[model samples]
Target: MISNEMAQRINTQINREMYSAYFYLGLSAQAETMNLKGVAAWFLAKHGEELAHALKMYRYLIDQDARVQLSEVAAPASVDGGVLPMFERTLEHERGVTATINEMVDFALSAKDHATNIFLQWFVTEQIEEEATVKDIIGRVRLFGDQGQSLLMIDNELAALAKQIGQGAATAA
Candidate 1:
């Protein structure tokens, strides 16, 4: 059985994941407004991924017989600059999530909640992948530039990535 404190922490994480979904959805809409269809598609895929993440945690809580508390998600911050700035924001958000997961892992370990610790290992791995992916995107944007033909090339690449992620989500489902 999961402890109340741990369950509460997981519930908070679920809320964060929901916020992440909302954040990505907002980014998708912003990309659409900028006419970056591929970027929009990518963010839309990310939104789906975030929702899946939240649901995964939600199910875990239910399986543990813990109460699930849903909370309101805050709106995503506005991005004033362009594509690079948007990606930078993504990286920043991901790093914050990593920190939260790390804290939870530490809490689980300290509390002798081995099962919860084990459960969180999946999230720890996921955070690593998420940060690395965003870093790679940032590097690519910097290397190729974020405008003209370069931007178009990046968009195509992102469209392919979106499709790949969408397929992975479907497979996981």
Candidate 2:
């Protein structure tokens, strides 16, 4: 059984993950409004991934015989600018998530929760990839800067990337 303190921390992480899903969904909406279909699809895929992340934590908590209490998710801000700004926000968000995961890892280590630590290893590695992916997208978008054809190519690239990441996650599971 997980300790109450650990369980509470995990629950908070779960809530944050859910909020991430909402945030990405909002970004998807903004992309759609901007007529960036590929970017919209990418954010929609990210929204699904974030939901899966939250569910993973929720299920893990239940499996460990802990209570999973969900809190209300805050509203996500709409991105009014271009793709670069959207991706910049995404990178910032991922960095924040990495920090949160690191905190959880620290807690698990301090408490000698070996199982939680093991489970969190995946997230640590995932954050590395997440940060890299956003940075790559930002770089690509910058390279394309206001070029419709280049943006299309980037969109296609992102679509493939989304599929690849989704497949990798599923295969790992």
Candidate 3:
């Protein structure tokens, strides 16, 4: 059985994951408003991933005989300017999540919770990939600044990535 403190911590992490989904959903709405269909699709895929992350934690908590108390998720801030700012925010958010995960890992280590630590290992690696992916998108968006053709190319690439991720998730499910 997980300790109350650990269970609470995991619950907070699950809420954060839900907030991430909300944030991505907001981004998707903004992208759709801007008529960037591919970008919107990418954000939608990310939103789904975030929801899955939350559910994974929720299920784990239930399996550990811990209460899964979900809190209300706040609305995400809409991006009004452009893609650069959005991607920059995405990178920043991922960095924040990495820090949270690292803190949890540290807590697990100090408490000698080997199982939690092992479970979090996947998240640590996943965060690295998440940060890299956001950074890459930021770079691409910056490079294509105000260039329609380049923007479309980047959008197509993102669309392909979204499709691949969706397919992988479906297969995993």
Candidate 4:
């Protein structure tokens, strides 16, 4: 069985994952309001991914014979500054998550919880990909600088990405 302290830490991370979903959902809403359908679709995919992350942790805790104590999630921040700012904020948020996960890995290693450490390696790799993806989007958005046709092109690309993500989930199901 996992120690109570470790379990509590994981539960806290789960709450953070929920907050991520909430934040991304707010981003999606803003994208939709701006008529950036593709951006909205992308954030919707992100929101789903965040929820899945939380559920993955939830299952892991249950398998470890730990009670899953959920904390309340805070409200999402406003995303009123348009796409670039939204993505910049997302990249910043992801960096924070990466740091937290690293701490968890360190704690697991010190506590000799090899199972948890091994499991968290997946998240470590995941964080790398997450940061890279967000950074790439930020770069692309900055290049466009709210230009009409260029921004539309990026939106189209994101729409395709959203579609691909949808199809992948459908196939997995």
- Best of the candidates, lDDT: 1
Root-mean-square deviation of each candidate, in angstroms? 0.6, 1.4, 1.0, 1.3
Which residues of candidate 4, in runs, are more than 4 Å off?
168-173
lDDT of 2 by residue, 47-83 (tens): 8888888988998898999999999999988866788
Q: Roughly what TM-score does model 1 have, to 2 decimal places?
A: 0.99
Clashes of each: 0, 0, 0, 0
What TM-score against the true fold does each predicted structure earn? Answer: 0.99, 0.94, 0.96, 0.95
Backbone-clash count (model 3): 0
Q: Assess each prediction's global lDDT (C-alpha) against the native.
A: 0.95, 0.87, 0.88, 0.90
Name the better of 1 and 3 by lDDT: 1
Q: Mind giving the per-residue lDDT tens digits that candidate 4 earns over 1-173?
A: 68888898899999999999999899999999999999999999888888888998999999999999998999997866788889899999999999999999999999998999988898899899889988998998887776689889999998998888677656743
* Candidate 2 clashes between residue pairs 3 or more apart in a chain or in different chains: none
Ranking by TM-score: 1, 3, 4, 2
Q: For candidate 3, lDDT tens digit of each residue in 59-97? A: 889988999999998887876678778888889899999
* Winner by TM-score between candidate 4 and candidate 1: 1
Q: What's the candidate order when arranged by decreasing lDDT? A: 1, 4, 3, 2
Which candidate number maximizes TM-score?
1
Which ranges in model 3 have alpha carbons more than 4 Å from their true place?
A: none
**Candidate 2 lDDT score at position 34:** 75
